[model samples]
Target: MVDFTFNAKEQEIIREIRREGLVLRKYARYYDEHEEELPPDEFPEAKEFAHIDKMAADRGADATSPTAFYMCMLMHRTWGDMMRMKVPFTALGNASVTAAGTDEQKKRWAKTRLSMANTEPGCGSDSKAIETTAELDGDEWVLNGEKIFVTTGIRAEGSVIWATIDKSAGRGGIKAFVVMKGTPGFELVKKEKKMGIRSSDTAAFVLKNCRVPKENLLGMDPTVKKGGGGFKGLMKTFNLTRPGVAAMGIGNIMACQEFVAEEMAKEGVAVDYEAGQHKRSAIQQKMIELEAELEAATLCTLRAGWLADKGKPNNLEASVSKQKGGDISRRGAQLALEILGAMGSTHDQLVEKWFRDARITDIYEGTGEIQRLVIARELLNYTSKDLT
Candidate 1:
C-alpha cells in the first residue's frame, strides 16, 4: 500500500537534520557579514547526529525509488542558510561527469573536487553562444578563454569546462573538458563579491593555452554530429540537477515563511487555515497564498526528481520545477519582507539576507526565461530554432 506519512525511521532522520540545522543557523549571520569565512566541513555539533548514510542503511531504504528523501534533508539543511553546509565530494561538475564521462573517467576523477564552468562574459542563458575554444594539438587539447561565475572555483581541485571544438557548428561542437587546477596556463582570475549566498565562493577564471591530455575530453567523442549530440548529452545533466536547484529555492521560501509565521504569532496574528480567505486578515490571506504557491512548487520539484529516480525522461518536468521554484522564491521573499515592514530590510535580521539570497534562484542553473523557453519548445514539439 502507498503511504504518504513518514515512517518512524524517516521521522528520526528529519528530527536529527532539523537539529543540525539549528546549530548551523548560529553561523549564518556571521558568514553573511564576513563573507570571507568558510564554514568548517564538520562542526563539532554535527557529531551528535548520526551519519545520513548510516541512518538510511539502518532503515533498509530502497535506493532506486522515485521518492527522494534526500530532497527533504536538503530542504531542512537550507532552511538554516541558503548556502547550507558544504559537504565534500558533491559539486556541480560531478553531475556533468556522471552524465557524460566514461566509466574509466569517472573512476579516475572520483576523488577530485570539481566545479563547472559554463557561463562566460557574453554567454549566460544562451549556452550555445559560449566563445571558449578547445583546439587539438597533437596529444594535448589546448583551451583558451575566460569563464565567469564559477560556483566553487576558488577551492575546487579541477573544473569541467565547456568549450567549442568548432565555432561554426554552434552547440554541436561544444564539448566538456576536465582541466585540473594548477595546469600551466589556467589561472583563477578573481573571486567575485556577490550580493547573496556570500558564504559560498564565486570565481572568474582565465585559460590561456591551457593544455591537458586528449584523454581528458569528456565522453571521448570529439566529433561534431549533425544534431547536436554532444550538446544534448551534456545538457542531460540538468534533468537531475534542475530539480535540486528548485528544491534549494523551495527551502529558502520555507525558511522565510517560518520566520514570518513566528513573528506574526508573537504579535497575536495567526494563520488559521480552517478559516475562509474572506474572513481572514490581509496578512493571514497573504500567508495562505504564499503557502499554496510553495506547496505547488514543491510538488513540481518532487515530481521531477521522482521521474529521474525512476529512470524516466523528465526534461519538461525539470524545466517546470525550475521555472516555478525560481518565481515562487523571488515572490515569496519579497512578500515576507513586505509583511514584516521596515524590520525586514534591516541587516540585523536573517530575513533580509534571505531576501537577497532568494534572487539568485531565478538567475542561476539557467534563468527562468531560459526554462520557459525549454518548456514552450517541449509543449509545442518544436526545436529551439523553430520557436526562439
Candidate 2:
C-alpha cells in the first residue's frame, strides 16, 4: 500500500473530495451501484453525471486556492474515486462564471454551479458548428437546441451553455448563457453508460424555448464584439481545466500500472527486471514496454500540470500531456489484457473497464486529433485562420 498522504492544504481539499465522493457514490449506488452495467446512452447517465457534478461544485464553492482544487483531483486518483470528476468539471464551470458573469449573476448561479463547454454531439471538436442558439428576447434570453454529451448537465442546478448569438458570425458570434435548471424548456432527455470512469455520469439535454433572464449572458453581447465574441472568455476555462483532465489521464495511467505490476507478481513474475533476463518471453518484453510508456505518460501529464501551477499558459504542453496520457492508457489496457490473457477481457477484473474508460479521454475535451492540431498550430506560428 502506498499510504499516500497530502500536505496540509492538499489534505484539506482531499478530505473534502473524499467526503463528498462518498456521498456521491452512495447516491449513484441508489440508482445503480453496478457502474459496469449502466448503458452509455444519453439520458440517465446524464442525470447521474449531473448529480455528482453538483456535489463537486458544492465542495469547491468556497475554496480560496486553485491548489486545493488540484489536490481534489489527486485525492480522486489515489482513491480510485471517479466521482471526483465533478470537482474538475465544476471548476471548469466556475472559470467561465468568474470570467464572464456579472456580479449578481455570479452570486446567484456561479457560487456553486457546474458549467461545461467542449464536446458536442455532431461536432465535439469543432466549436464553430455549435447549433445551440440564444436569441435576446426583451429582458430574457430564449434558448433552443440540443446539447449531447454534457458531462454534468443532468444534475447541475444551472449551466453556462454556449450558443451562437449570430448565425452569420459563425464562431465569432458564439456566446455563453448562465441558464438555470427547470427553466420551463430545459430537459435532460438521457444519460450515458460509459466504458470507463463508470462512476461518473454523462447526459444529453434538449432546450426548447428555455427562457433565462437577460442578465445571464456571459461576456458582452455578440453585437458588441467581433470574432467569436466570447471565445477568449471560454478559453479561460479550457486552459485551466485541460491540464486537470490530463491529470485524470495520468491517474488512470498510474492505476493501470499498479494493477498490472501487482497481478504480475501474483503470477510468479518480477516486473521490475527486463523480460529476457528472466523468462526470456516476448510477452514479458511487451509488458516492460507498457510500463515504460506508463512512466512517460505520467511525467508528461505532471509536467503540464506543474507548468500550469507556475502561472504559465501551457496549452501546447497540456495537449501533449493529454495526447501522451491517452496513448499510454490505450496501450496500458492492451498490455494488461495480454498479461491476464483471456481473463483480462473480463469486466469482473476491472482492467477491461479501465481500458474502455480510457478511450473516452482521447475523444472528449479536445480529442486526440484536436490536440495534434493544437500542437502543430503552436509550433508553426499558425494564426486562427490556419484552424480550418
Off by over 4 Å in 1: 1-5, 61-67
TM match of model 1 to true structure: 0.96
Compute each candidate's TM-score over C-alphas: 0.96, 0.77
Q: Quote the lDDT for 19 in model 2.
A: 55
lDDT of 1 by residue, 234-306 (tens): 9998887888888888888899999999999999999999988788999999999999999888878877877
lDDT of 2 at 9: 51
How many backbone clashes can be found in candidate 2? 16
Among the numbered candidates, top lDDT falls to 1
Candidate 1 lDDT for residue 123: 94
Give the distance in Å from residue 367's predicted Cα in candidate 2 to where it truly belongs. 0.9
lDDT of each: 0.86, 0.64
